[model samples]
Target: MKKSLIAVNSVAGAALLTLVAGAAILLVLMFSTDGDADADRRAFFGSLMFSTKEQADGSTAITAGVDDPVPLIVLFVVLAIALTFIQLTYRALKVHRQRLLEERGLA
Candidate 1:
């Protein structure tokens, strides 16, 4: 059971890392003005949550169709904090367990 839990956590961590990396890539690409209109459109509007476009009068327009990204951002921040806490707790527990085993000559 413990091994399965660890495996699941590893997969989840990998998935989270992949998602963060993808988001970072998209953000970088979104700002890259490569002189390609279609590519720029795709990159800028990649996310379904919200989109921002430049207007003709040098102003930006934000179009969020009922899906606000603030809550999603907050959720991601909280999840990151919780994941850090969980990892720290797991490491501490592992060290304590090893210490206990060594003290009892079981390791």
Candidate 2:
């Protein structure tokens, strides 16, 4: 049972890692400008707003959600901590189960 669970978890983790890597690569590709200043400026400014328009006075007009990356960063940190805790708890439980089986002559 435990071995099967470990195998499943390993597969799932690998899949998730691959998905994240692909997403990161896609993001990099999307944001890469290849020395195009206009595209670089567009990519830099576009990620910050839901809607945007250029004014004749050379100023940005932001519609919503300007500079909102802090919350997203915080969420990722919390998620990483939670996953670490879960993995540690799983490892501890596996060790404890092994100790119990050994004491009871079941393994």
Candidate 3:
């Protein structure tokens, strides 16, 4: 039973890691730009809510219009912590069960 629980926990942790990594990759891809002229200008103004000058390289480098990734970062951190806690709890439970079995001379 203890060995089974450890195996289950390991599988669950792997699944959780895969999910987190997929989400992170999706987020990164969504925020990536295509360098389209009109689209970039629209994104810049929409994000900044103001007009801005073009850069020396003929590109509009809007300082005020960066996408905030704080929420995503926080979500990932929470998920990782939760996964760690779950794995730890699973291992602890497995150990407790083994100890109980040993005490009863059942294993």
Candidate 4:
């Protein structure tokens, strides 16, 4: 039961990683600029990175990151969870390796 649960989790994690990668690729492609014709469409995607718009007073209003922010927030949440599991896996392997070495009186 425990083994099956682990197997399922591993598969789920892999699927999620693939999903995230696809999402990232889609975001990039959406932001891609072909030429000057895409300048208008690039506003939103550009804002995800950076932008500087001139104000009425001849001052520049600089901004960065997504204005909606939901996408960015969701992306961070997914990455954080993936990182947590990665760290847990690394620690577990290290501990298991140390335990095995100690068992054989090698450490």
Q: Please list the C-alpha lDDT of all candidates, in the order they appear.
A: 0.56, 0.52, 0.54, 0.57
List TM-scores for all candidates, in order.
0.42, 0.43, 0.42, 0.47
Highest TM-score against the true fold, candidate: 4
Worst 10 residues of 1 by lDDT: 36-45
Off by over 4 Å in 2: 1-49, 52-66
User: lDDT tens string, model 3, 1-107?
Assistant: 75566556655665676456555554443455444432332232122222344667888654333354444445456665676667778779999999999999999
Q: How should the candidates be ordered by TM-score, best one leading? A: 4, 2, 3, 1
Q: What does the lDDT read for residue 33 in candidate 4?
A: 40
- TM-score, structure 1 vs. true: 0.42
Better of 2 and 4 by TM-score: 4
RMSD in angstroms, all models?
A: 9.0, 10.9, 9.3, 9.4
Model 3: worst 10 consecutive residues (lDDT sum) = 41-50
List, residue by residue over 1-104, the lDDT tens digit for candidate 2: 76566555655665565446445544654445343222322222233333345667876554433244554444445555555567768899999999999999
Candidate 1 local lDDT, 70-105, one digit each (tens) = 544554566655665686689789999999999999
Residue 37's lDDT within candidate 3 is 35
How many Å off is the CA of 106 in candidate 1? Answer: 0.9
